[model samples]
Target: MHQTRLRITRILCMIMITALMVPLFSGCASKGNSDADKGQTAQPDTQQQEEKVEEKDPVTLKFPIWSTITEDLFTKLDLVNEYKKDHPNVTIELELLKDTEYENTLKIRNAANELPDIMPLKSAWLVNFKDNILPLDDLEAAKNNLFAADFKVNDQILGVPESQFNEFIWYHKSVFQEYGIEIPKTWEEFVNAAKKIKDGGKYIPIAMGGKDAWPDYPFNEFMPSLVAGDGDYWSAMATKDEPFAKGQPFYDAYVKIKELYDAKVMGPDPLGVGFDQSKLMFGSKQAAMIALGQWFGSDLKSMTDVDINDIGAFLLPVRDSADEPFNTVSMVDTFYTIPKTSKHPDEAKEFLNWFFSNAWYPKYMSEAGLQSTIKDVKIDLGTMFNGAFDVSNLKYVLNKGGNEDYKKIESTIKFDVKKMGQDMMAGKDFDKMMQDMNNSWKNARSKLK
Candidate 1:
């Protein structure tokens, strides 16, 4: 009986051990499947995130033009790239060419109707090819800016206003101090200063390059302001059926230029000198000053002996007693335009939107001494103007409707000013020159009708 009992007990123990092993194996298999299911569930979210990243990336754009290869351009390009991050669909390709060559090539392309999709157009040419360019009139991006009034052509807007460059008289502070001559505040003061500097026998008062012909434009912009005064003088001259050359302002200005010329205020070979040489003449202390744009600040910074802080600037002095003391002519530095034959007009438009809306531009452009077009974009005036530019009062007046019909008034002025310049250069009979210019403009207006 005892042997039989031992046999049965051993069999029972073996059967119990087999049962435990089976359940343990089953538990292991169940745990493996749970892990596999979790991994399968996470895969879709990871894949979706990658797809979202790709969708948000920007596309590349190719811009064909040549500009100064400076730190400013590089900063602008970098800002463009940052703008693309939020708008991954747009990319920019910079095609830099020599200045003269680029201008020639663009003219050729324009004539052949093979112009690039986007181009930087000069404002002077904007009116000539109004049909070939896209009007930014209805562009939600451009309509709400100060430039809207300036960039309009007849009933259409032609281009985006990038920045304005103002011309000023660049004088060497050291030279002024050494000679003990004050910087002129009025037209008479300026002439007197020039005479005093000439008498000192140190250097000529002005360094001008007549060979280029472009320098003549500044003189044109400057002299008229002195006689006509800045406030709609051109318009008054234009509408009165008065001749540009015959006007008191023109006569006064011509007399001044003749005085400057006869007194030898400018260098002897002014006509033979080029723009760079003129600046160099001033930088090397051969000339006391040069009348040019704000860009001269950058040129002078490159010279070892010349400190930019030592270079002082002043507005062209005006003769009208009641007018503002400082008179200026505004110049558009760069204007943005889209060609009529662009394959990617929508893309270009979208990129401009991104550029203007992005905050990176203000930071980028300001770092390189450029102004931003975006209204909210505030510049540290201390840095940009370097305490030289103080047009705070003018800004206030413009905002307060100082000149409500300023545009129409300014157009007439531009025509007279340009004609006055050409006539003076040609030595035409001053009275006849003014009369012809006025009638010519009157005829131009009649044709516009």
Candidate 2:
């Protein structure tokens, strides 16, 4: 009976040991499962961290524009607001200035070292401000859409042009019809047409805003381009010692303009009015023609009681024969640039890329009524351009590239051709004016050498 009791005790001890061991095994299995779960969850957590890192930090960019950002163009397009949808982090601060005051303001800001991040620059001003502007040749936007005149500065690209403008004579079709003036094909014919309208005494032949110096540019700045039929006329003139002589392109063109003035073709006291007054005179049918570029189309379209269909444009006739091809001055009007002093150059570049892309470029061109500088983008400026758009009938005279020697001489001499046009209208002696210009130009060139 005692032996049987000892065997029972040993069995009981084995059962006790097995019961304690079960809890230890359960604890180990739970730990192994927990580690496996963590291994599976770690990859997704790492991916989430990477996604957070990819998010862009918020940024603001300053965009300085002249006359383009107001209630008319930029506001109508809602470009900035639309851009924000995709790049929610970027905010564009637009600084608008009147076209007349823009260049001076920009110069002031540049001197103060406070240029905006994005600047709309005229092509002629690029060479002057290149030191402060950043080179954009390597940017994808520059590479993709830049034209011959765009971004070129001392072999480095400093900006990209958005659109180009061609100089022309905008006319009222009804006035031309009433006067029996067919579109003039030659300079002489153009004069005759003007004379006919002027002799009528009821309307001004050619409405001129000579008070505003820039309104005279089509005749002063672009006439030589037509007379020479060469894109490099201005630069080539710089090489000549007597570029203002009788047979020279500059002299010949000015002589033609003087003849027009002598004929009393421009309205009485042409210099007495400004651009707005001239536009009104033409819009009211009191004037038959006005010399301007494609930009004037929008203004004409906006006039009260003015029919858009009644407005027409033709390339300024410089050639002698209807059979001969005429040359037109086509130039890059405005360019986009990033100033070296910008705090957000990368963001500026991003904005430019977005601007020139296929998505937004067409819409911008349509609203601005400008021809595209980008390759393969076609813009129809409608009837306002008229014969100006026909490539077969015309050759293009692009703005001449800058020369250091010419730039120096131009600055020192300060020969104002626009002022010369006003003087001609005011009955100044053409011969004396030409003589003075020749003397001044020679002296300036001699100083440069």
Which structure among the candidates has the greatest lDDT? 2
Task: State residue 44's C-alpha deviation in candidate 2, in Å.
Answer: 8.2
Model 1 Cα displacement at 392 (Å)?
A: 12
lDDT of 2 by residue, 164-229 (tens): 778778888898898888888788999999999988898899999989877888888888878888
lDDT for model 2: 0.82
Per-prediction TM-score: 0.71, 0.86
Provide the overall lDDT of each model, using Cα atoms, as 2-decimal numbers: 0.62, 0.82
Top-scoring candidate (TM-score): 2
RMSD of each: 6.3, 5.2
lDDT of 1 by residue, 16-129 (tens): 999999989898988998899889988988999989978764555656656563434555457556766666666676677666576668778789877776677665556656
